[model samples]
Each structure stands twice: as C-alpha cells, then as structure tokens.
Target chain A: MNGVKSESVREPLILGNPSLGDVSDKIAGIIESPPTKKFWALVTITSIIALQGLCSVAYTVWVGPGVWGVNNPVGWGWAITNFVWWIGIGHAGTLISAILFLFRQKWRTAINRSAEAMTIFAVMCAGLFPLLHTGRQWIAAYWLLPYPNQMQMWTNFRSPLEWDVFAVSTYFTVSLVFWYTGLVPDFATMRNRIKNVLGRNLFSFFSLGWTGSTRNWAHYEMAYLILAGLSTPLVLSVHSIVSFDFAVSVIPGWHTTIFPPYFVAGAIFSGFAMVMTLLIIARWVLNLHDFITLKHLDNMNKIMLATGMMVGYAYAMEFFIAAYSENPYEQYVFLNRAFGDYAWAYWSMVSCNVLVPQIFWFKKLRRSIPAMFVASLLINVGMWFERFVIIATSLHNDFIPGSWDYYSPSWVEVSIYVGTMGIFLTLFLLFAKFVPMLAISEVKGVMPGAQPKHDHH
Target chain B: MEEQTLTQPVKSESAETEASAHMEQPDARATSDPLAVMGDFVDPNEVTDAARAIHAAGYTDFDIYTPYPVHGLEKAMGMKKTILPFFSLGGALFGLGNAIFLQWWTGTLHYPLNIGGKPFFSPWFGMPVMFELTVLLCALTTAVVMFGLLCKLPQWHNPFQKDAGFRRAVDDTFVVVIEAKDQRFTVDSATNLLEKLGASNVRLVNV
Candidate 1:
C-alpha cells in the first residue's frame, strides 16, 4: 500500500488546494461574470481586425487573383504560404488534446479545452486562404470535391490537391466533434449552475441532458477514448497530406521525401508557440495562473524546444541531401534559398526555428513569463518566414533565368494574412468569454483526492 | 465549506411525498407514487461504499453520480462494459469500402485520363484519402452512437432533474439514486439504508 501510494503521488495538477466546487465556481464564474472593460476592449480590437480580413477576402473574390502579387513563375505566393502556416498553427491543439491525452499527460486537462478551441479557430483561418485563392470562390466547391456534376468530370484522384480537400475537410470536421464531445459535460455543469433563463436553455440544449451517471460515464469515457485514438492518426495525416501538396510537385526544392515529417515538426513547433503566446496573455488577464501553472508553461516550452530542434535538423538535412543528389537544380535551389535574393527570409527561418528556442535550455528562461512570451512571438514569425522561404524562394527562380522574378505580397495579400489573425483572436476571445476555457470536469478529475481511495495488498 | 459538514444526516426540507416504506413495513407502497430516493455524498470513497452496500442489498437499479468520472464507482455498481469500440470498427470498415470503390471506379472505369504516364488506379496515391475518410467516419459513429443510442443523452426531461438536490451531482457532491421502480425498492428502506451507510441529505422525490 505504501509503495503504490508513493508511486502514484505527485504534485497536484491544480494549485491552492481547490475543492471540487471551487473548481466549478472558478471556471464557470468567468462566463457568469459580466464582461470586463479589458475584455470589451480586446473584443472590439479583434472584431475590427477580423472585419478587415473579411473585407479583404470579399475584395479578392470580387477583383480576382490578379489583385495579389502572384505572377507567372511565383504563382503560389502569400496565399499558399499563409494557408500552410495557419494549418501548422492548428497542429499544437490536437497534439495537446489527443496525443498528450493518450500519453496520460494529466497536466493537459488545464488547457486542452482552450487549445482545442484555438485549433478549430486556426483551421477556420487556414481554410479562408485556400478558399479565397481559388479566384472564383463560388465555383470552388465543384473544383475541390468529387461530386457528380453536369460536366461529367471526376476530380483527379491522383492529384495531391484532390487529397488535400479530403484531408483538411475531414480534419476540421473530426476536430470539431472531438472538441464538442469534451464540451458536453462542461456544458451540463453550466446548465445546472447558470442563473439566466436563456443561458440555462442554451446550455440545457447543448448538454444533451448529461446527468454524470456512472452508467452514462462508462459509455462517455469509451467514446472519448475512441475519438482521441482516431484524432491521433488523423492529426498526423492532415499535415502529411498538406506536405504532399509540395512534395508531389517536380519543382527542385519542393520534391523531397523529407517534406512530410519536416513539415509536421515545424507545424507542432509553431503551433505550440502560438498556444503559449495566447495562453500567457489569457492566464494573466483571466487570473488563472493557479490552473495554467508555471509547470504547464514549462512543459509547453520544452515541446517547442524539442520540435524546434527537429525542424533545425530537417533544415540541415535538406541542404546536405541537395548537395549529395548530384543535381544542379536542387543544389541551386538550396544555394539560392541561403545566398540569393531571399537570403533574409531563409536566415530568419533558421534563427527563429533553429536558434531562438535554444534559450529554453536555461530552466529560468523557460519558466519566465516575459522571456517565453517574447520567444513565442519570434518563433511564430520564424515559422511564417519558414513557409514563405519554402514557397516563394523555390518558385521565384525557375530553371531558366528568363522566367525568374521577385515575389512580394500586394497590400491586399498582407491585409488578408493580418485579417486572419484578427479573426482567430476574435473567435478565441469570444470562446474565452462565453465558454469555460478550462475543461471544468477534467480539471476537477485531476485534483488531489479526486479519485476514490483504494487499499492495495 | 459549510456544505462539507457531514457529521449528521440532513434530511431534505421538501420531502413532501409520503414516506411509507419504513423499516416496519418492507412491502410495496401505493403504486401512484413514483419515488426515487437520492443521497448526497461529499466524498467519493463514501459514495463507493454506499453503492457497494446498496448493490449488496439485492437492489439492481441504482446509480452513482459525481462531478467527474470516479474510477472505481462503475465497478462498485457492476456496470457492463460498453460496446462502443465495435461500432467504431464498423464505421471504419464502411468508410474504407466506400473510399476504395469511389477511387477505383472513378479512376479506372468512370473517366480514365493519362496524366504524366501514371497508372489510373494505384493504392499508393489513394492511401491519404482512404485514411482520412476512415478516421472521419469512425469518429462520427463513436460520438453519435455513444450519445444518442448507448447513453440516451440529450434527454432534457430526465426524471432526476425534478429533484433539486440532484443539481449538486454536477457541482461537488457524489450522488446515489435507487429508482423506485426497483422490485426490492421501498422509499423508507432506501432512505434508511442510505442514511445508515454514511450519506448526508437523504430524500425521496417523485420523478
């Protein structure tokens, strides 16, 4: 009995020794309390930014793809770059919720609800770039899907682009359902506690009459385990298919077998950085430092550090493979990436993706709020440039020098990217306000004395 | 913290229903009354004990409820393992079959075009779509079947909701409810048994 107790015992996931009711009151109270002045200010700012991004999308649809800076050789410019970056940003959420949950990372319960929300919002932002880039947005459905139309043409199953349609759409749908399944119990808690009639009715409808019965929990736990199992593979597959978009192409820099794993690492790295950036501000503003503890921040920073090294290793491997292949086209692409016109972007990627996270080796910096907050921002910037360096640098200089030209985003392109940020933040803010940002039920489950005591022989 | 005082059993104020099933009379009460005796428990260990005691007393229709899933309580109540994984497997097979048919038929038979001299139908290229669809279908089936069919959730009018004390189950308290429909169930015996086994705020409410 003593041995078993010693093995299982550890620092509590939640701090201040909160009781189960305190856990409910602390989380649900965020939603019940009237909106604070700071909350309104942030909402106003993000909503305005989101509106601007929506307008940019509308303008692009009205004006055509010519409004952006994509030319003959550099056709896949900021739009594709932003699409990949946004999608990569979403990977952290699933990594935390599905992957970490399977590994029995008890600390994830504090932040998984919000991280999954961020994942859905990030994917929504990611989808906008691809949808708007289609030029004729109205007819995109026909082009993307294998639906039977009067044209009698089937979407090319062999094409990686066709694979992307299934990969991303399936990813979004599955993530949404997985997130909602976790939310149902939390919603039931809201249903029982909220004072207002309208809020109560809404929670009642969404909660699905969850009574927390052990019989029902038996089924609910099974369903949750199954979803997490499915999402683990689905998350890896989504980004691999995204990588297939570039890898399947015959372009010198793009055609590499290493793209899938490399892209996945970079996605997790950037996604964690974004999560850290948002979480730091959220914990501070919401006064949830006890729940979103320094330990959680330290764990996240370590992940960013590990994934950052994977990305750095992939970057070096790409160069070595380019030189070893005895192919001048590949060699030139790598050389041009580092030494030619877009050297600034390449170096930025290296510094941010490779160099910046090295600061986390110091335990103090990893746990320090200001140090991590700034590092998270720089890492995301580095990731964005990493995508741009991959896309624009490869496309800008072609086989023949005659077709070579510089690529830069037009105002519309720049605004659209910024607008997506606005849209993402606005949705996150709304979610933080209206929903229990912490998984209330889950957080309670991991608290000290949460489980029934058992005597071991 | 005042709510955690469990030294004495606090009988519910609104036990307006007839308490006809006292220890003196072990027989059935009037059939008109649909009584579900609920006991509010402060600790999970105590709830497990009460559930074990109630189950051992030959009552088959009883449940334990808590704010979150209590690990041993399901075993203490003797719940059968759910078959949700089987449904998930069925969904995966269906998705895999559909994806194979769609790709094979469309690529080879429906409209075959020679692009870059690649084969019309190769499983290598088709794997991504197949994997995505399989996961998507499996996830959907698990969620829908678990909530809608197996658990019978989204039931806004659950009989337990009529008892106001039941609200604490989702908040802090662990609850055990022995349905009045149980053959061995009597309101007085259920209430007396719960109070005897260290449950606080015992009450019988018509559901």
Candidate 2:
C-alpha cells in the first residue's frame, strides 16, 4: 500500500513534463535507428504477419461475418467469448486507477498510463468482436439507437443484450476521455519541449493548451478523484451485469445468481493478467524498466492471485450449491461439465485459474519477473478456456438428452481468433514503440512535500 | 517525525518577553497565520503550541503539507465527497438500457425464431453483453466526469507558468497551500498566523 501511495507522488514529477527531455531523446533515438540483423528481421516478420491478420479482418468484414463460422446453438461461439475475454482483460485499469486511487494506492502511478492504454485497446478488441459478429458489419450505427418502428414495437428494456450495448459503448467513451485528459498535460509538456515542426503541432493539438497552474491542478485532482470513484463501481457493476447475462438465463449452468460476482472477479483476474503481460513487454520494449519494476509486476501478480482465489472460491461454492439443490437437471449439468464432453476445458480452467495461482504463495515466484510473466500468460489462457467451457459445455448439452450437440471451431473461427490476437499484439507493440509507457506526471505529484519545511508539532 | 503538542503557559516569561514570543492563543487560533508563525521560530520545542491551536480552531482552507502525507487530514476538514457516483450511475443506466435494447432487438425482435425451443426473451443470456456494457458505461462516465469535474477537464490551462522547479509534484513533496478562504487569509495576517501556529517561512504564492 505504501509502495502504491509513493507512486502517486512519483507520477506528477515524471509525467508532468512530456517534452522529450535528454532521456526521451535517447529513447527516440533507439527506436528510430536502423536495426542491423535480428531486430529488423523480427520487426519485418511481425509487421507482415499482423498486416495479413489485419487483411483477414478487413476481408471478413467486407465479405461478410460468415467468413467466421457461427450458426445455430453456437450462434455466439468464440467471438463472444473473445469479446468477453478482451473486455474482461481491461478490468484492472479502472480498478487500479479509480479504486486504488480512492484507497490512496500510490503504486498505481507507474502502471496507470499503460493500464489505461490497455483498457482502451482491449475494449477496442472487444468492440471489434460484436461488429464482426453482426455480419452485415457496415450498419453498426443502427446498434446505437432506440427507434419507434412502423410495427409499433419497441426494443425490450429488460434484456441483458440492451444493457451490454450501453455498457460497452459507455465504457469505451469514458476510458478515452479519462485516458486523454491524463495525456493532455504530458502532451503539453512534449509540445513545449519539441524543437521540430511536426512534434510541436501534434503535441500542441493534443496537450489542449495546458499550463499546469495550481488551481487547474487542484480542480483536476478533484475531478480525477470523483472519476476514480465513479469508475470503481462501473468496474464491479459492468462485470456483474455481464454475469447476469448468463445467470439470469434458464440454461442449466447459466441460470445461477452467482454469475455476477463470479464473472466480475474473473474479469478483473484476467484483466490484471493482461495488464501484467503488456506491462512486462512494454517495459522491455520501451526501456521503461525503472518506472515499471519487479515491484510493480509482483503487485499485479498478487492481484491475479487474489482474484484467482476468489474465482476458485466461486467455483467451489457453485458446485456445492448445485449439489445441495434438489434439482437433478442442474446437478446433472454440473456432473457433465466435469466428466462430460468438455471435461478437458473445465479442468483446464481450474488449472489456469485455480491451481496455477497457488504458485504465488511463494514470494520468490512472485518476485521472479519472468516467472510472473509466464503465470500471467497461463492465467489468460486458462481464463479463456474457462469462458469457452462455460459457454460451450452448458449450451451444447442441457435439459433434454435428445437435444445434445457437440461444438468445435471451424477454420474460419480459428483464423478470426488468431486475427484478433494479431490485432491485440500489433496495437500493443505500436503503443510500446510510440507512447510514454508510464504515467510520468502522476507519479511526480505525490512526492514528499517540495515546499519549504516548517517546524511541526 | 512524531508530532508533539505544546501546552506550556508563558506566564513565567515577563510581559516584554511574552510580547516578543509567538503563541497561537487557544481561543484566537482562528485569527493567526499558521505559516508565518513557524518562520519566526527555529526550535522544534516551540511546535506543540502551534499544532494545538491549528487543531483546536479547525482551519478548513489550510492543509498540512509535510515531507509525507499527514494521516488524518480529510477528517480535519470534515470533507464530504463530491457527486461522482450520481454521474457514474447515469452512465451505467445508459449502458444497461443500451444492452437490454440491442440484444432484445437482434435475438428476440429482428429475427425472432424459437431456436433451441428458447423463449423470445432470454434476459439471462443477455448478461454477458449487459455486463460488458455496464462496465463500459461506468468506466466511460468515470473518465468523462473525472475530467469534467475532477480534472477540471476543459479549463484550458494552469495558472502556474513553467519553471523546472514546480515539476516536483511527482518525485517528492507534500504541499499544503492555504487558500484565500482561510479565516486568517490576508498576506500579513496569514504569515503572522503561520508563525504563531509554528509554520516556518510561510511564502505567499500569487500565480
């Protein structure tokens, strides 16, 4: 907690000035220099592969969503799962920036900028899924409205789908605003420092004419505190509502009250994992190691462990509740999930989310950056499988014996999944290369008082 | 540093000595400038009297900016939170409405066929979408309100012109700037008040 608190003090000083100082100039030089052999090769290969994936998405959108196979009982398939996964992956940023801020966690300063960026990018990836899933893809604007139709029918307000429309879109908008507001001062700092024409113009536009006056800062801090408070609940509620989508349903596994908390916990768990992954890569790529240290990774791992434990608790309680209930249908569904067609996926989820987190019990493992990185990646894979098992297993077989069907992804589904992965990594790489991967200003703000010392009682 | 309160009476000091001495009368604590009072004194021994007076009177606008954060300042100001949640709720509700609307149209209204013998309305299945949207909305609102309200988003710029020195908000410093609202807010009075309250070198910042 003290570590986190110190981060706030560090952020303002670091992030306060965006102008590429002597250090920033050095960073710019490295990224711009022509790579000799291995580095250039990796960059070229990655760009081509990502470009192809980009083309694949373009092709899918242009040619129709059918390029990815989703039909009938599995109308959602992996696309929705990916959407949930990506969106869930962003949970920690708002949680960190807002909840931790309110709690006075200063350690958040080092990670907030990148986490916020991750939130934006993850949401972007999440947004793509629905639009791509929409198939027609072009008339996405229609999804944004509530109209009075000639048939005299209005959209059902009770459905979770409608709630999702509002939740995801609103999340995207707010994250952007929050992220940009934080960036403005840094951008202004950058603008003020630039010696070149292009740099000045770009920075000036983005900085929004900031001068860092104390009054403006005071109000800005107030606004930030309020926003942080607002985002905290949004983090909890949004995931809970998502859980409701499954929980509120009559499907044997889906219809449970526990969905909201379970899903929200899982979202945060996965989101933190994603943040960890990106931050590690970013720190290495952008040379932000001092700002994002082992301490930061360890903290994130601790969160992952905690959330993972919460998820495991939920999982355990879920089975207990299911067995305790008199209903055979629900009991049978639980039995099927463990020993039935998708048993592998269910266990995979356990290993990833439940068992793997136990490793963090050792401080040495948590502190080992590479090990933490691996754990984060495994958790993400595990969480994805968790969603897949949740969606596919329950939906594939439930209620009646005769209605049972097996599900598997086709080549198109595989490619689309890969493509989304491509997009996620590509955006992340670009961000690592371009942006100040840490919240420099906010970290500087909470430093031990810079003012003249007075004798204290 | 551990803070100790000064409670000793100056009756032993001669009236002439007492006149030269700085002490925030427990009763007139509100009238003194806490910062300047500290500037006049160099000894840590004199601080207790200053702290007690600052504490007793409850100056709302003046904060204690120490080398580190003082643990219980918010309680001192009797601070109440500003309206961040209301705006967040507004954003969340908007998201919920959107989630319910979009899903209902596509699954139930746009192509209403009983697939899997499922009812036209599956509010449960809508949870994933709704959850995402709700979180999205709340986050969105938080960001917007944070800037609009907390960050003072569109105020354009800060009054502090750039000097390399002011950039230390991040690395090291806790600052308590006394606003004009302090009961003893006049430049001279505030300075005097700070000294009486045991503050050292209370500098007035105009910009």
Candidate 3:
C-alpha cells in the first residue's frame, strides 16, 4: 500500500545539507547585497502596475461605484470578488505561520516569513476594495467604526458587514503583531551585524533591545505560542466571517451552514497557491534554493493538493445538498452556476482547481518545479473565478427572470483587479529585497546537533 | 590552562570571603549600580551546562542568552512558567464582555430599529464580532505583556551592548550573565566560577 512505505518516502526538508551558518548567510545575503538587475526590473514592473491600480482606485473614488459594471441585481461585482480573492490569499500565510506551527511542522520555518508578509500585503489590498466600493469613503469609513457621538448613533453590530469591519481590522492588527514578534530576534541579528549608524539605529529600534536572554526566550516562546493559538482560530474565523457576509443573507446559493468551513478551505487552497507563485519566483530570483528547497515546494504542493480536493468536495457537496433538498431556488442557483450565463467561469474553476491539482497526486509531478509553478498559477486563476462565480452568478438572476441581466466588468473594474496584483507583487518585491525572507534563527534551531545535550542526574 | 585552573580555587576562596563581607553591607552599593557579571561561551552546549552548574551553585538571579531558544535550557536555568496565558485569558474575557455589551447597548438599548422582523440583538449574529474581538485583544495583551512587562523591551540602551563579545549572543555565541546584586556575587568569584564552568570571556558589565 502507498501508506505502508510513507515513512521511508519522506524527503529531508532542507536540501543540499546546508549548515546553520550557510543557511543564515544565504538568506541574509539577499538582504545585504545590492539589488540585482532582475530585482530592480521586477520591482519597477510591479511598481508601475501598483501605480496603475492606484490610478484606477483614484478614478473610481473620484467618480463613483458607477465606474464598475454593477447593476441592481449584481450590486456586488468585481470589488467584492477581488476583496474575497485577496482575503482568501491572505489566509495561507496565517495558516502556515500559526496553524502549521501549532501542528509542529518544521518546514514552515522556511516560508513563514515571506508568507506572512504576503498575508499583510494581501489584506492591505483586500481592505481597500470595501472602502472604495462604498462610493463615499470619508463618511462611510468613520460611520463604520463604532465611535460615540452627540447623536448616539452606533454601527449595527448585528450585521455581518459590520462583523467584517471588526473581523478584518482585528485580523490585520493581530497578523501585524504576530509578524513583528517573529521579526524581533532576526532584527536583533541584523542590528548586531550592521556597521553603519543608520542600519544599526533602525534595526536596534525595531529589535526592542532583544538580547535573546533565557528569560526573554522563555517569555518570547510563550508569547509566540499564545499568538499562534490565538491566530489559528483567527485565520479560520476571519474567512468564516467573510463567508457570513453571504451565508447570513437569504440569497439562494449564499445561505448555507457549510459556507464557513468551505470558505475557510477554499481560502487556504488559494492562499497556498499564491504563496507558491511568489516563493517559486523568489527562491530562484534570490538564489535561496538551498533554504527554500525542492522539499519545501513538494510539501507545499501536497498541502495544495489536499486543500484543493477539500474545495472540490465542498463544490460537489453544495450541488448534492441543493438537489437533495428539492429547493427550487437553491437548485436553480446551482444549475445557473454550472450551465447558465456564467458557466464559463464555473467550468474554468472546476477544471483548474479540481482537475489540475490532481496532477499533484503523482509524486513525480508534485516534485517537479516547472509543473508545480504552472499548476499554482492555474489554481490561483481557478480560485479567483470560484469567487467571481459565487458572487456574480448567484446574484445575477435571483427569483424573478424579469430582473435578470448579464453582468460584465467595465474597464475600471478590471483595472482595479489587475492593480491589486500589482500592489501585492510590489509589496512582495520590497519585502524580498529588504527583509530577511526566511526565519534565520528558526532554521538554526532545527540544524543537526543544534540542541544542547543535557546530562540528566 | 592547567596552571590557571589550579590557581583559581585560591582566588575563588579569597573572593568568597570578600563577598561575604560585602553581603553584610549589601545596600552600600546603591540600587543604581551596575547589575551583572556577563560571560560569553562559544558553544551552546557549554553555556547550557554552565547555566545548570550556576543554578546548582545556588545563584538565583542569572540568565543565559543565545541566538535561538535552546531546548531544555529553560528547565536547566530553572525559569518559572510565565503568566502570559492569564493575561490573554483576561483580555479575552474583557473583549467578549465588551463586545456583548456594545452590541446589546447599540442594537437593543440606544437607538434600536427593527430590521426584517429580526430581534434587536441576536447572540448568534453577534458571535462573529465577539469572537474576532476576543482573539484580537487576547493576542494584543499577550504580546504587550510579554514584550513590555516580562522582557522589559524598548530599552534600546543596555550595558551589554557595549561589549562586542556580547553582541555575538544575537548571532552565534551563547552568553550567561549572573547579576552582581546576587547574594553570592563578587567580580572575582563570578569570574572564577564562569571560567571554571567553561566560559571563554568573562567580564563585569556596568549599566
């Protein structure tokens, strides 16, 4: 059986058998070195794209949500689709950092930093959509927050949209702190290494006088553990809350008890794909193959495969439940998703997400870098379409055929979506250039013979 | 090296007598005086062993510093479990209570309006916000309590920063520092003790 030989089949996570010093040098060297031509080229392109996104957003705000193709029935269009897509991409980072850490997965150490950075950046992009979508951000933003005023008006806490406000903001804040806490020790390392005044001062300020003392380590470990515990539920809850924006509604396809878990699974599935897309390029561009090795990619591919299957199962279950219940509305929604106006989006999602990831079930394909990269890109496209289909198809034709209209995104809406990619890439490029993209101290901890042998009395 | 080891006991004994004399006038050295005798070890194992030895030698106020958290070193150094969990729990409870009160106050008490015949406040509807706030506050409190209270962070200036050897504590070296204010501390005795415990470079750091 495939299970019988599992123990012998597993590969060493860090390839090339690099030493701790070598690992630190290779990873830190990327930050210390002058930016390469390719690095500059990538950054410039991404920056230009980010600029385009900014322009699109400015245009949208200066005009109105009318710039989008959203109409009466399809009120939530590209903005909500992109918002959910970006938020879902953000999930993989917390999953890798917090959930995997809780499970004691050591491979996460290689990618957690970059993934968390992606999470922060992706969430930043995701947060912009709802604000811009409001059409009057200045007033809507303040109105969203629960602040005391002379009128005694407060944000409706009973609404899932309000829950989104709190959930997303809290998720962002906690993720930031969690990310920074992990950075402290490495910042201390950088502070110690730098010779110049500016570098030393900047790093020292951020490092927070971390001496790596046993007492500090004791407390630091506890804090990390606690944050991990807190963030694990948060990663799940954030997406579940995002799902609540739909599930709590009485829309035909939107209302379901399975939405929370299914959304969470889809979030992680998409998130891992995005992480793979960025990291595959990064590991090659930055020459960090020794640290972010084939083993790491293989393991990540395995996760994508698993989660992708979970999503596919959820997709099938939705249809099964719809048909089994004999509810005409729910049944119609599923039928519309499959064979109606937005059927192209639905089939693309199914083929790319459900079918393509199955290639990873073969051990050979999972380990192949090029194959995995292509699959990752496909999965990302699939996941985006999954969101688009859910939002557009479900909302497009409700109960009345008289109100039905074919929805198509305007240029502004399309530009904004593409612009988010630019924003995500630009931030990622900056992070790769400036930050220690791998966990140096953590990798050191996992080195052979790194742990001290105690003489038990 | 053998001669150095042989001559250490005499020096340690004399320092012990001097330390005993100083112990009688402990407050004579003001509280503002420098705190610790710091030593650097090239090997993590050596520092871990030294931490155990120093703990066994009855010195309570001491610490080991390393680039990464050394497994089992907490137990070896006899560090007590942290109270961060309690702080997190306290924060969570506060956040949950605050969320419920705010929801109840805003929806039911302050300016309530009926929507879709739903109740003014539903606990199920409020669960998402409550859960988010609970996790948010719990994580924030844990981080604040850990970095601010326990670790005493944001003090960018530390006496150990002046020592180039101590800087390696954040890189590849391991360091052990026994506070000068400890009952058994004297410069000579602490130096001898650290040297005997395989410390490579031992020095007294003044803040």
Candidate 4:
C-alpha cells in the first residue's frame, strides 16, 4: 500500500484480505466473549490508578486547593496544566472523526470509533481538574452558570471562564451525540450477533429498533453528515475558547494573538500522539493489524510530525515576536523561559515536542512500531510540559522582581495528574473491551468491492 | 424450500398488464387480513432492482431493509427528502438568539458590573458562547428530530423482528416488505413481482 500522500488513489484500508463476514466477526467478537486475562490485568491496573485519582480529588476538595501547590505568584499550577493537557489530548478524536471525514480521508474509518471514545473520556478527565481547582467545587460549579438567583447575581458573560463553560460543555454534548449516533447501527449488529438475552436486550435498546431500513439509513446518513459539519467548527472553537482563557489575559507572556491557532495545533498534536500511543498497544493486544494497519500508524505519525512542527513554529514565533516587539517584560519572560529556573521544562518541551518527532521524517522510523510508540509517549510528556511551561513559567516570574518566587508541585498535585491518566486509561480499557472499538459498518464501506455497481442511466 | 418455488418466473405476458389486472380487482384471498408480504434477497443489487420494480409498479407503502446502507437504494425506492434540516436550522437560530439575549440581559441589564472598564455587553466577547450554543442545539436537535420524528425510533416490538429471514437483515441479507394495506397490494402480484425482480424468498408475515 502507498504511504501518507493525499493523492487520488484508493488504497485498501483493511489489510490481510479479510472478508466482510470475518471483519464483523473479528471486531464484534471482542465485545461478545469473555474478557481475556490481559484485558482483566490492564483493567485492574487502570482502575487502581483511577481510584487513586478519585481519592486525590476528594482530598483536594476536602482540604482545599492548598493541598496542592499554588501560591501568590503562581496561582495556576499543575492542575490547570493537566487540564489543558487532557483537553488537548481530546482534540484528535474530533479531528479524526469530523475534519478528516470532511476531507474524505478513508483511513480514518478504521480508528474513528475508539478516537471518539478517547475524546469523551479525555474530556471527562479534563473536566475534573477545573472543578477540583475550585476549593469549594460544590458551590463554585453552580456559581459558574448564569442561573437566576435570589440576589440577582449572574455570571459575568464577558468572562472567558463563562465562555469556557459553554464551549467545553457544548463540546462534550456534541461529541457524545456524534459518537452515539455512529454507534446505533453497530449496536444493532451486536444485538443480532450476541446470544445472551441480557446482552441482546441492552444492544437492542441502544440500537433503537434499527432495522437498517433504506429510509432510516437515508435520514441517519443525513443526520450524521449534519453532525459532522456542526462538529468540525465546534471542535476548532473549543480549543480556541480554551486558548482565550490564556490570550484574553493582559499578562506579558499570556497576551498574544497567536494563542488560538497555536493552542489548536498543539491540541491536535498531543491528541494524535495519544491516539498513536493507545492504538499501537491496542492493535497488538486485540490483534487488529488487519484493521489498524501499519499504514494507519504511518499516517498518524505524519500528522504528529506536521502538528509538532506547527507547535514548534508557534514556539519560535513567540520568541521572535517577544524580541522584535522590544517589550522588556516579554523579552524577560522569553529569556527566563529558556535560561530561567524552569529552563529544564522549557528544554524538555522543545526536545520532546519539536526535536523528537523529527525522526518521523524518515520513512523507516515512521513505520517502526517501537520508535513511534516511544515518540508518542515522549510527545505526551512534552505536551504536558508545554502546558506547564506556559502556565507556571509565565506566572512564577511576574513583572515585579519581588514576587518572583519559584513554584514546585506538591505530592497532591502530582497524584491528581497521575490519577487523571488512570481515569483516561480505565475508561478507554472498558470501551475497548465492550464497545466495538472499530466501526464495523464504516470499515465495510471502505473494504474493497463492498459497494455495488450502479448504472449511470 | 418455499423460497426456491417463489423465485420462479411468473407465467404472465407483461408486467404492466399484470399490475393493472391486480389493481382492477382487489382479490378477496389477497386481502384476508395479512399484515405484509415480505421478500428477502441475498444481494443488495437484487434488492435495489426489486425496489425499482416495486416503485415503478406504483407501490408507495413498501420498505427496503439491508445489512448496511445500500447506496442509490433510496432513489430506487423513490423516497422524499426529509425535513430534519429545517428542525436543525430552527434549533440553531433559537440557540443563537437565546444566547445573545441571555448574555446581553445578564451582562448589560440584570447585574452589570464594569470590569476593567470594558463594555457590559460585548458581542465580540460573547461570540464563542453564542457559537457553541448554536452548534450544541443544532447537533442535539438533528439527532432527536431525526430519531424521534423522522425515523420514529425506539419501536422495540416491530412485527418484522419476529421473521427468521429478518434477523439476517442486520447481518448479510437484504429484504423488501410491501404492506397489505397498500391500495394496489395483492399477495400473488406482490410475490410474483418480487420473484421476477430477483428475490430469494417471499413470505407473508402477520402483524
């Protein structure tokens, strides 16, 4: 098969020459049968990790945000950093499902379902941070909304935080609907394939009595198209609004017009990396080489390479603009980022996000599973540090020299970050075991000779 | 066994004559309270051809079911375009207006506070939320409206679900069902048409 060029040629997405029956049977089998020992082992580990995160959140809520690390100089620390990191990781799913779909990328059909699931779960993980960041989350959560109150107090509509409330929540709702709508027909397939009454009933309920009627298919296809159309902008707008949370500020390092596009490109960059990390393992574990082929992995790595470069350019531009603008504070911030106390993080971000992904420029390394996996893991690390650098470095060293106190994350902050990973992995593991990780009907659509020939007349 | 016999070519002169003859007389035997006459086809191509023949013969109350969506099957079935887009548009407009009005009312009128000397109701600042709410409502309305109003889903107990051949509709079979309630439906005529159009099995199902 041809590699990662956007030429007008049809490559067989499903390799190994599997028939339609074999495709359905193999994918649906994972969900139908009992979980394997490895599946149980992975689930158990992720569950424990998730439980740790839950406990960390509980302790943070119990004591206050002080349990973590946040002082006068650096108000936003690891919590916000992890929030941005997780949110960025969620971007790839929508990009794969909506953007690539609009571009007619058939390679996406093999991976979109799991990617969408990853988006939802990652958003769920990301949502936990903002809530936990608020010391009194119970009250602070409701206070974020603009519901009428006895005191007639309303949330400031001018605040980017309020805009964020609408943006992220709308994003979650749209992603969930888009994900479930795609699942309906596949759920019907499961309902017919499974033998257990309970399993059949559950699938049937979700399937909504889908008969695959031509009329139902017609409407279903239209609704799906409209949703994809709507989600494309919604996905871009989500990260843009997230960037607004930083760009709207007047702080020397935070206030920049390029934050929106920079953050979006970074989000997709980290998202594709995370998808690669997960799919690489999943392809091996689930024996999905025929579906999630090396071709798919190569294409994803190329995206990581491109977006990583875009992020790298953003990094360079920020420095260039900082020096060119001749703003002392901005120059100081840039200098401090490179040679300051947080220089370790700055260099790490540079090496991981920018330098490491450059290896994918070679065709062999791009196709190498181990190299791609390592690069993806490093990219995730780099992306997380990228957020940390953006949030902590800028905040730690303010304009006034008196307030330049170094900040370090306490154990609580570290645990919460690790716990979010647990939550993400746990949800993903369950999704892999239960839901058809591959979109069966879509895979069929891309299979060779699946479509019937129609007369032009 | 019965499917083999049903696939035999009808021993008649022309499809038009047979269809008109069936339409002229509503046979009592054919109208004996049968729920529907269902035909199963192995290939989607055959189903598409059968759908064309059935539609051309002027059967309006027929439906085609398949394992996966068959392209061009809707055109062959002569189905009309759905009204779901209008619902989505309406929802989007409502959401946009509501967001604008709510943000304006809250930021400007209800409990306005001048922060950093910025305007109370900045439409520029509110654009993201407005855009988000519009997309949110549009997506949700499209899903609910299509599933609830158009597809009329959650129909857990459709009579066709009991048919053995119908089970394969979600697996590897294509089926066409013509309701007996149609003005021009007769058992022999429907079964003969389905067979002539290349159906593998034609069975009459009770509601």
**Each prediction's whole-model lDDT (CA):** 0.88, 0.64, 0.85, 0.86
Kindly list the per-residue Cα lDDT of model 3 for residues B64-111, writing each as its tens digit. 888789988888888788888898899999999989898888889888
Question: Candidates' TM-scores?
Answer: 0.94, 0.70, 0.92, 0.93
Off by over 4 Å in 4: A1-9, B1-33
Candidate DockQ scores, in order: 0.56, 0.11, 0.41, 0.40
Cα error, candidate 4, residue A226 (Å): 0.8
Worst 10 residues of 4 chain B by lDDT: B1-10
Residue pairs in collision within model 1:
A208-B154
Best by lDDT: 1
Native RMSD of candidate 4 (Å): 6.2
The candidate maximizing DockQ is 1
Model 3 alpha-carbon miss at residue B47, Å: 2.5
RMSD of 2: 11.4
In lDDT terms, how accurate is model 4?
Answer: 0.86
Tens digits of per-residue lDDT for model 2, B70-132: 223333334455566677778888988987777677557675655556677677766656666
- Give the better candidate number (2 or 4) by DockQ: 4
The candidate, 2 or 3, that scores higher on lDDT is 3
Question: Residue-wise lDDT of candidate 3 within A237-259, one digit each (tens)?
Answer: 99999999999999999999899
Better TM-score candidate (2, 4): 4
Candidate 2 fnat reads 0.20
Q: What is the lDDT of residue A348 in candidate 3?
A: 99
- Model 4 clash pairs are none
